[model samples]
Target: MNKTLQTDLLEIESLLELVKKQGIEYLNKIDERKTSANVHKAELINLDSKGLGARNTLQLFNETFEPTIVSSSGPRFWGYVIGGSTPASIMGDWLATIYDQNPQAINGEGDISANIELETIQLILDLFNLPKSFVGGFVTGATMSNFTCLAVARQWFGKNYGKDFAKEGITEKINVLTATPHSSALKSLALLGIGSNNIIKVNTIEGNREAISIDDLESKIKTLNGQPFILISSAGTVNTVDFDNFNAIKKLKKKYNFWWHTDAAFGGFAACSDTYNHFVKDWGHSDSITIDCHKWLNVPYESAVFLIKEEHSSLQVESFQNSNAPYLGNPMENFNYLNFLPENSRRLKALPAWFSLRAYGKEGYKNIVENAIDLAKYFGSKIKESENFKLLAPVRLNNIVFNISNNRNKENIDSFLTQLNKTGKVFMTPTLYNDQKGIRVSFVNWRTTKNDIELVFKEMNRIINIIE
Candidate 1:
């Protein structure tokens, strides 16, 4: 080994201690950290023949790059429905890195990481009040989760016509119906060769709602003329947190033949509360569902799962199986995650979620979900009462979508959000809703409280005065 490598091995315990101390300090002071970073270009350093040891490299990194790190994982980061890591989740994440296990096969080659992954999936299903009839696996994020489910849906759509789209290429255009799909789902369609432009956009509810119109969806299906199609529905829309009527969609399943897929993502957490459970009622009837652990589950990034009905297990394997890789064993006989999901060699991403669920059981999650919803309502009410802001939509679930009441110019709302973010106290995302420029404040972080909302609201008023 190189001298530097030998030194690092000898000092591994001390190096880890230093890292743990830094991590603890960062976590302890996260709330005080800037919500947004003042990013600037850093000078590039050329590599030398002689290497710097890990400790020196750590110091160099702290001096050069650590200053601009933002607190997106901290409370008051009400943007894009992001969630912070729980203490238990952080522990599991550290172990996952240290173990360096690739969760692939459950009963093959003495690898049990995939079994742990399966157990984690079961825990998630129980958390969501879902049935065991659905088989699930962890993926990178909501984007990849959406991709995996939709890939299976695509295979099912093809199988309906007695065609195998996976073995052979997509031989024909597939009919996909949806309303207000998350952009990630559309990107998945593009990746799967389903052609995002080819989707039939169903109209949302008639007034002030993003939920799909059941009548319009039925009309679109009629155009298919009894052909098999895929209906990509939403459990909770990102902007307004609007939920499609899963009950109505479930009713339609009796009369129509289509693959039902709901991208629940964060909104699925509503099931944790009695008050908000109605938003996702009947969602379990869907053929597939995507939920993000990194969102309301409060796990770290790069963790999400896709739950597809067990009846479609064959199709899922067919959609993602690697047929020619002999070493992976029989795709059907051995039952590996690599055969069921998009990734072939993924880390034990399920560990954090497993740790989270085990640490805080059903009741604990109920508190987290309820608290988030209540804070969102509190913030939304503040926005409604303020003369400076107009609620663009109802304070549905854990998001508040609104517009600046007085500022008519489109650029002004964007400027207001930018300034508010510059304050480093809070961060929000801007959007265009129904042709009107709007801002969205999502409250999914478990640490966020009423006080945080009040702080952000006061900051917003200050910025409003400056912009006006």
Candidate 2:
């Protein structure tokens, strides 16, 4: 054996000793960083440090690595509609990385991966009461999810209208109708040859579309004058926690033959709760839906779900979608996952979502969703009781859109947000609801306790009192 290659017993023992000691210590060091509150900030380290040994890397990790592991997992992180990750999900994520399963397309890896993805998709379909035949795929987050769904919509429309959007591209005359609160991803969809300027911004009631009166939708559709239409609705809007009038919009979809897409990135999963199911009820009929498992499901970063009303919607978009090389695509030809998504190689992030759903069961998910909704209501009620605060809209789903004061202008409104963020007692975001600036809070974390909301109010009162 070569001198360096043939492991001498002494050298092997030394290597093992280094690995065991350093590995154990490094893991403990990471764990400490995760469980601590000092993670509101972090430092960086040089990857190419000559002086750093294994001990030094561990030391550097200790000195630098700070976890963004949000208190969302803890009882006080009431910032966004983010879910605290479950232990089972974390373990599944680890296994996925170790195995490094890349199920971006269909036929790259083990059946277990694709099947896990299919099964997860099935569960979501069942959860949403969608058709069993609907096709679904795992994506990064809502943005990609929205892009995937809208891309399918574009493909479907282009195919139906005899336009080669996949090759010759959009006719430069296609139009998409959406609301003001439509997620920013819509802008990206517009960039995907859908034409941002072509989008017709409908007036919405409240922050969501549940209040979108049928009259407004009818009037808007009537004005279209035979233009191609792709109607986008929200299952749960980010601001105002409003769900677009899906029931009302469904009627227009059938009448106008428009591809109805729902961007329920954060809110779509809320259907897990019976109380909130009405928000996304009848979603089955929608041509496409975009959902995020990482938000309410608490899986991990970049776990997005895209569902299509018909099978092979992904395949239809295949003109622009990825196709595997003969060497890679031909052998394991049972199913090639790459055909569906824009990416060829992607992390098997679905495993964690599958594992999480299996571990939690439907009831477990329902309970968690219910808990978050209830907490939001509880917080909304608390805010309502305070004279210093104002309720901007009805507490619907899990978002509380309210203003700290009745001051309704551009200058004071901007000042209020800056003050609140600077205080850092609570991190809140502002939105435009009914053409007015409203502060919104999302109760997404399972760790968020009732006491946390109380803390938020106390802090808000302190800040408002000082500023007022």
Candidate 3:
């Protein structure tokens, strides 16, 4: 090996050891008052100041950096549908970094690593019961996944007449129909050529189930005439964790001629469980669906998969895609990475998922998902039993949205949320449902157990009693 390369590798090893020690040390003492929350609400320091070796800088990072992040990987972290990755996934991530494979096309990582991603895509398709011929791409997160799916949907619908709407841009108006609790990623669709103002909000909360009915959806679709309409349904909504009436939406798509897409970012994995499969019964009929492996599958961060109905539908019609002549491709055209993804240079992001799924088969995944649902229901039962806590929305899936109410001190809601955060027993979030402030807990972590749920209930009762 080259002397300089050897030296660099040695330094990396040393740093890894040091960081591991510091990380464990920091995690052990995270409850200290000095340890602050670090979810975009934390301090922003310059890159140089944040780096190691500087006496005070190293001290601050070692003392604070990770400990303060309120990581979802933590045993009690119940915030924002985050998943705790398995050791196998972590090992695969390390290998991905060491190899530094850029799977843009077959030329980047050859057929080996790129084919692994294709396999991951196929696995996701089968897991979700999507069409066998559906195309897929690895993206940064559900935002990019939704963006990619909608981008393809726009091109597919608008370019049906060879109009090239992406390049020419949407000269005519278009509307994306969706219900409340739509994944925030819808904003990405608007940002990407599809006008944000054109979003048609459908009333999903007609009853206890929290799913939008076909009657409401069909009425909305009738309002839009000649304009291109794309119906976006949620497989797992953020607030309620309720799936849209996928079967009803599927039937509507046939009659309306709108491109049907499902944003199953968090709950898509519910399909892995036999019990929750009914939530996404007709999901296979969707033109496209977004699944985030990092969320439900307990993989590491920054790994989400977007699957489309047809392979050719995902290809960008822009210059970059057109520039690369398909015929003169590398030997790995059997499953070239770039043919599917919007990204030219891609990481081996699928390995974590590949490792996790293989380590634990479909049955293993099913158990964890079902356990999460059971935990949610357990907590919901606690809320229903409590005279103080009002179940905000009906317990649908793994997400339980409810508010703690007393004699009628409404302002205490924020105080209650802060108390929960301060105690660090379980991390939850605040949301407005039916114009009322509420606490929402997402049982997305595989580490979560009956004990964890009991602890959360205990802590919540303690806080509610304190306020009372």
Best candidate (score: TM-score): 1
* Residue ranges of candidate 1 with Cα displaced over 4 Å: 42-44, 326-333, 407-411
Q: Against the true structure, candidate 3 has what lDDT?
A: 0.73
User: Over all chains combined, what TM-score does candidate 3 have?
Assistant: 0.87
The Cα RMSD of model 2 versus the native structure comes to 5.1
| Candidate that would win on lDDT | 1
Angstrom error of the Cα, residue 10, model 1: value is 1.2
Model 2, 1-468: lDDT tens per residue? 544335444365665566567545633443132222343453474566334444445455555552333233444444555666776787788678778877744443444466678788988777666788777778888878878777777877776677767767776566677765355566767668776676777776743344455677677878877666777877777766677767777667677867788888778766777667887767778887888888888887778888876554443445334433432333224555566666667788888888888898889888778888899899888878877777877888888888765552334656666676554445666777767777778877655667767776777777666655
Residue 163: error of model 1 in Å? 1.3
Backbone clash count, each prediction separately: 0, 9, 0
lDDT of 3 by residue, 101-133 (tens): 776553434445766777877777766666777
Residue pairs that clash (backbone atoms under 3 angstroms), model 1:
none
Against the unseen true structure, what C-alpha lDDT does each candidate score? 0.89, 0.68, 0.73
Candidate 3, residue 382: how far the Cα is off, in Å? 1.0
lDDT of 2: 0.68
User: Each model's RMSD to truth, in Å?
Assistant: 1.7, 5.1, 3.8
